[model samples]
Target: MKKITSALVALGLGVALSASVQATSNDEAVAERIKAVGSVCIEGDDTCGGAAAAPAAASGPRSGADVYTAKCASCHAVGVAGAPKFGTSEWTDRAGKGMETLLANAINGINAMPPKGLCADCSDEELQASIQHMIDSAQ
Candidate 1:
């Protein structure tokens, strides 16, 4: 009877130890699975990676029609939110406000239009060009 009891006690200890080892392995596997796959380094953070590369040189300022089509057409094409409709009298009337005022509105933003009209990278000359393109489209 004592021998049987000792055997059962040893079996229980073996099972418990095996279960503990299995649980530890499972935890390690879960951690491996959940670890971040990649990391991000902000543009100037040397500690994260290395010195940020300089921005590529631009070919030059894009043409007025190209800038207008890419950036301005979304709203101006149909006069969304009161933007002057392209190729319509609305642009003509806004043109009467003069280029100075128009450029101000474009750069500084007006009403529903955000500054630079969603073209954050566009230079002042580019913005002026786009404005002129729209003005020229006036019918």
Candidate 2:
């Protein structure tokens, strides 16, 4: 009976040791996986330090004539969509509406004319200069 009791105790200890060893190996495996997967991405990583900043504006504003010749002429010169032909009496009626009205119409669009006449990125002031070019041509 004494020998049987000793054998039982030794068996229980071995079982406990084996369970502890399995638990420790599981913990080690989890730790190894975390080390492999986790990372700290800083300045040099995939985000690449945010978007690049836009360049500064030009020293002075672009000229009205330049803006018109490049953008307005596409529609206005040929009277596309009933747009008054450049330098025609057709512009006289629109000119009669005054410069402020013309600038607003050019920037926001009116009748068959598109906003900025499809120059979407044009600033309100740039559209104003463009209107001035058409108005100047009519004179």
lDDT at position 93, candidate 2: 77
TM-score, candidate number 1: 0.58
TM-score of 2: 0.54
lDDT of 1 by residue, 7-53 (tens): 99999999999999999999999999999997887787667754344
| Model 1: ten consecutive residues of lowest lDDT | 49-58
- Candidate 1 backbone collisions, by pair: none
Q: Per-residue lDDT of 38-60 in model 2, one digit per residue for the tens?
A: 44446555564334332355646
CA RMSD of each candidate after superposition: 8.4, 9.2
Model 2 segments more than 4 A misplaced: 1-59
The alpha-carbon lDDT assigned to residue 39 of candidate 2 equals 42
lDDT for each candidate structure: 0.91, 0.80
Give the C-alpha miss distance for residue 108 in model 2, angstroms. Answer: 1.4
TM-score of each: 0.58, 0.54
